[model samples]
Target: MAWLSQYQAIVYGNGANGPILQGGRSVTEQAIISSETRQAPQGKMSALALSALGIVFGDIGTSPLYTFKTVLGTAEMPSDPATVLGALSLVLWTLFVITTVKYVSFAMRVDNDGEGGILALMALLGVKKHHRPSIVAVGLFGAALIYGDGAITPAISVLSALEGVNMATPALQPYVVPAAVVILLALFAIQSRGTAEIGHFFGPIMLVWFVAMAVMGVAGIARHPMVFAALSPSYGLSYLFSHGMTGFLVLGAVFLCVTGAEALYADMGHFGSRPIKLAWFGIVFPSLILNYAGQAALVLEGAPTDGNIFFRLCPEPLLLPLIGLATIATIIASQSIITGAFSMTRQAIQLGWLPRLYIKQTSSEGYGQIYVGVVNWLLMIVTVGLTIVFGKSDNLAAAYGIAVSATMLMTSALLFIAMREIWGWSVWAAGFVAGCFLVVDSAFFLANLTKIAEGGYVPLVLALLIYGVMWIWHRGAAAVSQRMREALIPVDDFMKRTQAAGIPRVPGTAVFLTRAERDIPPVMVWHVKHNRALHEHLFVLRVEIRSVPWVFGEQRLTIEEVAPNFWRAEAHFGFMERPHIPELLAASKSLGCTVDLADVTYYVGHETVIHRDDGMGMPAWQEKFFAVMERNAVHVSDFFSLPNDQVVEIGRQIAI
Candidate 1:
């Protein structure tokens, strides 16, 4: 009731189940986040429940579709009964240790502005001052790793589930690629429709899938009750120590079970953190553990022909139908990854960590549903290629854990920085926790490296390519912007000369959409020099990025009376939020400012960055990268919706 009361202004009465907009706008809340607000309605419970289903449920819900099968497939058909039981035992406990304890119980507590994800964590640790290169590198690397993780998730998730159809009915094997493509295309296609349209069904679908997995696993365990003995921690420990050289290598496959765990945090802003933790502890966790144990028990009693333990868990009579069910579940899991990639890209652009790519919001209130054409088509091509080349989900398994594990390792390393530097947490306490995570993460990383020749090269190459592009763009753009700044006219001199010239005063307000919050834009300085008198109201506005996306309201224009008649208003937007200056200006009647929207002139500064072999310490390759980026960066007028009659563009040139 209190949470609902806080949101009373935004909550309009509903029509059936669809919420109606009232005074302002509403933003959706993700699970596994500790934020104070949820997407309207009732801010607390419903949000938490949906987020729990959306965020944490994706990775684990889909794991039952693949984990046991991949583990046993390593030994080929007629999987060793003893080894199968042992490995399944290993997976069960791994989920308990990694998911239940590390993530659900502890990591969800570390949130930034009610946002949970690697970027939020990085923002919490990042130095606000732009001068800190190490902090910036940490942020970029973390961002790069997330993008890399994004690309791989769809490939593995989709491929693993589709492989089920192949195992269930060998006749369906040839249709796998076509089926996967259709599923993937459908996944991207529905993104424009918004998750809110279908989100209500996600909980029920996941509930059914979990129930099916549990029922299947329970049936297997009934046949071989002794498989429960594998629950002991000693079984996992014994397998690792006893296997000689190959034991270390098995960790690569083992790590796949926890691959989507980070999504639990990354997508936390979409769903609240509480529900995600709840789903894992209450439903997802118990179901996954039971299913894994059942697979192990089935393997111990008798080996299957093709070594697909997951499919084998189902009786032959129902195998095909179950395969169909698993395929649908995996499709949803893959869709979650694709959407996560789009969200991460938007965050990077807003934070100035990435070059602007065209971003389109699909839903008015549901920020999670989005469509980025560039990301969608590119991901489809890469994922389809991976399925064709790897030919099986087990091969993709090696590459899968490496990028995500590295991201987790890097996040933990940065979390240590946050503890000591930002939160002022004790060094010993931070070191102990971070050190343990690092050790676990590193072990997984090394194991995955063994997979490089065995189809692990895909994500590794992808991560490197992504990182290089980001670094180059950052360096090149800085050089170009710096030179442009040097060439611009000073604001003080511009205002003085223009006023002395006795030019006529403008009747309307002039608004400059700026990227910087403090300094006067070069174009503004020039405008004041040329125009003599300021508009009735002058606004030098910049968008300030929050840690989370679309969660906070736009900053109110900070109106200051600079001179008797001159006024300046600054407007800020969160990194995850969009600011429509024109719309905000029109709506300013609530802020006690009356200005006709048609009469107001919006001014934008456009920079043309060039390479002159001069300014800053940039490498030759980086200079080339900047040239490409500058060519690619969208014009300021186009990015911000401003009219042709009222828009003014000032060009400044820079060389890197």
Candidate 2:
């Protein structure tokens, strides 16, 4: 989905600097501010922790429903206590090291102001394309892989949850795929309504899920007390060496346990680190450990390995209810993944890595609750298709951990840079600390790489496609920007020529939207040359999207008079803030340039790119791809929220 991958999407509330125009009236999104959830009052800590359970922990929280079973299935060895204990140990320590110690104890501390995630970290580290491009490409490729992860999450989660039904009764097996498709379709269908009204229930529902998992786990563990030996890291290490390649391959499956750990770091901005930590330590961590142990205990005590061992833990009387609960939990988990995709897409668009699209805000009271039809529908198609193709959670499991493993590996790399540059750590110190993570991440990535032929290519293929779009889009945009700069008009020279030519001034205010931040817009120069006239009050406006989440009102605009009745202006929006020219201009009124919004004429540049066959440019394939993307990108009028009726588009063609 262009919406999802290009979200590679950055999303945010437009602006209170100026409100968004719905049908006609001015409207500001009430609850989309990044800061609102960041600085909660002391009383809201418990509430935030509860909310964090829903948004941050959904993916990992639902892991128990499928993870332990999948791990056992992948190991494909006898279910003796020694093997069971070793697998359990690997799972427990993996949870502790990856989720608890690394993320909760460390990565959460590395925040961009208050936000987290790869992009936020990139912005904080100032990993610009010019300064360090390989690193930027790595960061972007990792971020793009997240979309691959996003695509698989819903399919695997929901499919696994519904598989519990087949666990209860084999006769109903034929219905699982269709039912999952229906559930996924419904989930995507309701995305446009936003999650504000129903989101509040997420935390409470997940809390119940954790409690249920813990209870069932305790019951299972009571049957085989010896299974608790998995707590020792020695057994996990022993398991890895004893089984040779099989143990190493098992690490890939074990990785599924903490695949969602990145979300804790990424979404730390939403609920803050403290609440997330509280939720993990207080509820999620214990629940997961207990549940995985429970599944292992059931197997150790002679439970069948083929049918769902997770459902085996539940008493026959309660099996149906457990199935329903697991299904609901999976849906919640899928929702979080989809919402994340939407958010990342908006970010990618704002940062110039993707073509701009019409981003629809779905909730006034929801946090980053927006929907892209393209992203939603495409994700739905893929998710449903995977359900049909893979057929069983076991088959889909082969595809699950690959993308997230690579993403985590990349995050570890970036974390090393942050330690060196941000924390001013010595290279050796950063290496030692990051090296431990690298061992785990690298092991898991390599292990998962073994599955590429077994459907792991699904996410990798999706990720590569998305990454290709990002790479091509960024390079093409740079070329276009360079071309415009090469052809720019010097303001002083233009002024002298205009005086000599005695150009006539038109009435009212005219706003020319430009890409140049410090140079004269070529579109304006082209306009004067052809039209041979200028507006009495003209503003050369350029919109700048900053590297942070929200750029506040006081710091949003800057204006300077370049010459008589002509102004050079820059409107700065955060990556999380949408750019609306009318509202941006309205904010300029506060800075001494007063103009009536109703009467102002907005002029924008329209580029028609022509691909070149020359050997000097990008490969011919890339040239064509970039041209197609540019041609299909959201028009300048809609991206900047200009008044369509009063807007004029001037066309220019360039070869890239």
Best by TM-score: 2
TM-score of each: 0.87, 0.94
Go through the candidates in order and give the C-alpha RMSD of each one to the true structure.
Answer: 4.9, 4.4
Lowest-sum lDDT 10-residue window in model 2: 6-15
Whole-model alpha-carbon lDDT for candidate 1: 0.64
Candidate 2 lDDT tens digits, 198-311: 776788999999999999999999998888888889988998898888898999889999989989988876667888898999999999999999999999999888878888
How well is each residue in 122-204 modelled by candidate 1, as lDDT tens digits? 66654444466676676667667666666667666777777776656678788877777777777767665556555545556
Q: Which segments of candidate 1 are over 4 A away from where they belong?
A: 1-47, 75-82, 130-132, 421-424, 487-491, 515-520, 525-536, 546-557, 583-598, 613-617, 641-645
Clashes within 3 Å, all models in order: 16, 14
Give the C-alpha miss distance for residue 427 in model 1, angstroms. Answer: 1.7
Candidate 1 lDDT score at position 136? 65
